[model samples]
Target chain A: MATKLARRRSKAAAFGVFNPNHVVGGRVAGLIVAFWTAIALLLWIASPWKTLPTPPEVIHALHDLWWNDGLGPELFTTLKLIFHATLITTVLALGLAYLTVVPAMRPLVQAASKLRFLGITGLVFPLTLLTGGGYALKVALLTFGMASFFVTSMAETVLEIPRSEFDHMRVLGASELLIVWEVVVRGTLDRALEVLRQNVAIGWSMITMVEGISRAEGGIGALILNENKHFRLEDVYALLLVILLVGLGIDALVGLLRAVLCPHARLGKVRR
Target chain B: MIPGASVGEVVLDVKEVGLTLEEHLILDGVTFQVKDRIREGITTGQVVALLGPSGVGKTRLLRIIAGLDAPDSGTVRGLQGEELPAGTVGVVFQDYPLLRHRTVESNLLLAGSIGGLSAARSEARTQELLKTFGMEDRAGFYPGQLSGGQKQRVAIAQQLVVPRRFLLLDEPFSGLDPAALEDVSKLICEVANLDEFNTVMIVTHDIRAAMAVSDTLYMLGRASKNGKHVPGAKIVGEYDLVDRGLAWQKGIMERPDFVALEHELRGLFRTL
Candidate 1:
């Protein structure tokens, strides 16, 4: 008991911000959340909508999109791409991270991966040069171009794990497999998930861009491009609204997973 | 001729060990042997405080012994019977670094799992450690939800996920206050005594804490990585506090000896 008290006192002394007497009211948390919502509402209100459709019109448009026939199928197509593309990215990332962190393979793999990163720079502009067009090519390019991004981000997260954590496990007599599964995989999951979160916006955008270039049957990018090419400005904005809603939905899903998989993560909980 | 050369038994031995960080000589010519088990028969225990001036390589020596670093040269030998490599031993550091993402139960599971603890036995050990640490209530909470003392307790408990013949700790009680330090020290004693009768070597400059719990003690001197004594870096003195008078033991913290020792250690750094 004395020890517990002393620990509390010492920690209290170290961080001066915490007021022992401060009671966090449930209402204050709600109010702070409302303040953010009010700001978003104002942004939506002020987004040059007078020259186009207002926020209410956009909401009504969304209602029609949801309630109208065939739109649900269009939404599902984009969701499917997000799901498959994320899975591919994660798998490639995990494999690359394994190669990067596994000690026996670390040096050779790191050296090779570094070279791979250099090689990967070719993806940005070179793809526009080679295999210039076609739906198949666009999908292939998106997958290939983004594949290295997945590997780099995941491997980097795995590499950044503290060495001390590994040493502690090594001394405990943990085997390489157990260390990988329990220590490395478990420890790095949240970080890799964060990498996933960071790339979500970019990943979707890239996939949509490729989809449009390839003349893919579904996805917001294709839909927006087709409408804009036809000079259907109202449809273009309407498609833009659809894309924003879907992006928000995807963001919300990842956020929920983040809360479940790594609740203690102090950062990335709030998104812009 | 070495007076202690004929010491009958040695379970863990460090011979002519040294380490350096940047240009700073962290540990110099540190030598000690822990003969925790003689002929597989556990012997009476001794708690030795590794004390020195603050800049000495006290903690570095402990880390080298823990296999956290490769000593510039020399050797560390742990139990010959165990499967550990020629120079491997279990280690615990100053910061507990318990996994904040996992439950107390899962944390122990990770420790046991990564330590290559038998899957069944390790899981069982997790349950047992939970009971032993009186952390059954905390078994479900993440590290973020735990208090500092509890986190350290869990960290210490995590160390016991698997037991070996020797344990190396690097100033495990530094940031903790007197009472918490005592509790942790007592807990360390109990855990070490219960496990394979693991010989424990703790590195600390805390004179009072050194007296609090230890079977024997060594004072480190700061020397180059090659273990040569520098003009300013020397242990200067050593002591065996176990047999000291009760008055000295009880009053050591408030006494001149500890204060003078503390000042002497600080003097080594300031003069250097």
Candidate 2:
């Protein structure tokens, strides 16, 4: 019995330490560190400067831009556009999805599906002619480019909620509208948020395209376009880095919200 | 709890109900009566177990009674000839079908709101149910965080958030551990006995669970003679619990009378 106990103990020791609680946290930290290191290496190699901007130099550049160039307002404008676009997409997508399930409104949903193939960039001429430059044009471009996918993806998410859930709500005395609110909306909210996070990058790309064409007074896209025209390679690279950082930050914030709202989703290994 | 409805009376009747799917008859002239049973102001709620083998149309029969699927002929009524109000019959589906994104407490609140309860009433009922099902600690947890037993309890509790005329549990004991099965059966007994619940019908193949908690037993099986394909299956036997006073008591299965009754129930199934 003693030999058996010793053998078991040795086997456990050989297998290595196991801290089940911290495994997920440790792995996530390692991944983040590795990712940042790879980005820094790429930036260092690509820089034309004799002395590449080290981590400190990049941090200083971020600080310099924020204070001297009205970068704060530009960043805020870009963020505001993306935020509203996501909000509009969420509401409109959910509404379209709700209507799709209704027999009377199903044809309207079918008609909306055709928008999936409608190209936003191709509509630039008419959009500029109708809405014209500045905020309206930007929003219209972003909405037109992204709303169709959002609506279809959200509708599919809503549809995929098992029919049994709808039946459960009905038997519990819920009306058709009530089922739409409870079973359909609450059921799809987290998934819809995830889809928005995935599609926001596409929205960002569209924002850049629109800004480049129309020359907005402010926004990161305008900053990038201005930097590009002057051939300020360092400034352009720095602005791109800023864009990448801000995008990641926003995605992380949305992920945090998802963690809070749907705690069981366990979306990330990193501990809150 | 709905106005104009009386407690301690027959609330649901499935009379000569026939259902067919794609030319395959599922329930043929299936009939059952559920009376609200109360003792000393505590509903001893009548648990009528619908015992049947797989593919014997138990689920289809349940759907018909819940009014989710229309029967080809005959009638299913609540409060005599009056149609059941929207929330009269709450069904706990076999898989629980919980809103995965919402916390346990919010799920109950959602159900209450859909049932037209006031905000204050919904909040009160949500807390009450969370406590009743021994899930107060898990109120903040989402469905994905729960064990099978906890999910099952929440599913049933959400249905009861609004006082229902009848509660239908589909295969409630399918995947429970022995201890969990015991706990769930006890909960069913306790909840059914509440004045708010008139009748609780459980569909299960687990005779032990049925024998432990149900006051009435119903067995359903295919009746094709000599291995022929029967078009439909019907109720085979019904047993009253009045004679077996100790059936609900723990370890009742070890009792001679309980064992004898279990044998008798198995005998009916064997003949099918």
Candidate 3:
């Protein structure tokens, strides 16, 4: 009976792509990833379109961009801008979201969240006039672009919190301010991290456009625009790849931070 | 064998409490009182069960008592004989909500601090409660890592960390297996015996489980008069197991009288 049970367990773990509630082992999962990669490579090699840059060309362009074109500094500038914008967005968005607990602040928060629907192109002129159109403009544009999304997600996180949690805090003799601190601020910190992680991607995607508005401080966005204008398709593709890799790295870092700071966020159903 | 139990002055009084949501009467004229239970000169606490079928306003009534929700009519009086103030009563929700971002220890510590414990005292109380709940080893574990039963234990312990006189549990025995059910029953009894002023009101549909752990049982359902069903739920039945020689008895389920009462309550529950 023991051997039969073991055999059943092993079989169940071996292949479970189509099975609900069945998780494949690490080896099986790795194999599945490799299979998809192989198929993607074959498709890339066989594509009829020749205008797309080949892998070898893209790699050579990457080497040139790194060695001669100051891609390193440009990338650094973009990252720095992202860091500042994210810091400001975090403060502003969180303040607005947390203040929603007060009846008077809800309409203002709702207005801020609704600003996400407004296009950045229309607001760029006004923002440039407001910030005098320099590095300040870049940072302002990025912050403006990101804060609405951050507020939207963070506000939803606060709203979705079960009423019972607030009640639980009240029962613990928590005052209204303490309840906000415990249930809203501290309770949603991990979720805030997750929301930040998601919005950082949006920041990355928008940086190039924001940088175009004020080209005094050169960033990857400015570099991409320069390359694209010159019809340097290979360099453009290489810069795109660089952005992808950097975005993935930032994502991994945020995930690591969440794991360390909120280790409980990752845990799910440990079978005794 | 009887544990020398005696009832004292009422600590909680609900008089003519009524609620209406969207033109539908949920609870009307729901009145009851929980008195201090003294045994051998120690306040061993009293466990009261609020039993009813689903959607019978059991949860709503519990909320009103905890001051989380306000009833349209009537008032809930606390030990001071005034309107029950927010933070005066502790509540354990049916889903056993805990801070998912925090470890069990951090969650308890926060509760203690909210309960007005000093930092040093909060830490000591957290450690003690962790040990009491058999969660000392899992103190670093997150709520998501623990099973349903473990989360329930943490939820209960979170309340006790602050020395609350009253705790309300909604559906404490809903989804437990038999062994877990037995464990929770014992845990409820142990908590009740921890303090003389401590009172637990458990709202559940599980008649047998509630009967096993509670000294007082109240049923909520609509009354009938002159062949017409009443519009709202109220305290339709009340039983004092202490007077019936059934309170605080181990292996009470095996008693013939206990089985008979279970059958009787089961019949009464179907009517609700």
Q: Highest TM-score: give the candidate number.
A: 3
User: What does candidate 2's lDDT look like per residue over A49-125, in tens digits?
Assistant: 75445555666777778898888999888888878877777677668877777879867776775687978767878
Separate DockQ for every predicted complex: 0.31, 0.52, 0.67
Score candidate 3 by TM-score against the native. 0.89
lDDT of 2 by residue, B74-140 (tens): 8888866677544678899999988776788988998888778999999999998888888999998
Candidate 3, A1-272: lDDT as tens digits: 99999999777666557677666667877888999989987887676887778788989999999999999999999999999999999899999999889899999999999999997989988887898888888888888888999999998999998887887777777888877887899888889999989888889888878888777899999999999999999999899999999999999998898778876666653422
lDDT of 3 at B2: 59
Which is superior by lDDT, 1 or 3? Answer: 3
Badly placed stretches (over 4 Å) of model 3 are A1-22, A38-48, A268-272, B1-6, B38-43, B79-83, B225-228
Model 2's chain B TM-score?
0.90
Better of 1 and 2 by lDDT: 2
- Give me the displacement of residue B233 in model 1, in angstroms: 6.8
Report, in order, each candidate's fnat: 0.46, 0.85, 0.85
Q: Clashing residue pairs, candidate 3?
A: B43-B196, B44-B196
lDDT of each: 0.65, 0.77, 0.88
- B30-97, model 1: which lDDT tens digit per residue? 56666552223433344456766565666666666676678786677755633235124666677767
- Output the worst ten-in-a-row residue range by lDDT, candidate 3 chain B: B1-10
TM-score of 2: 0.81
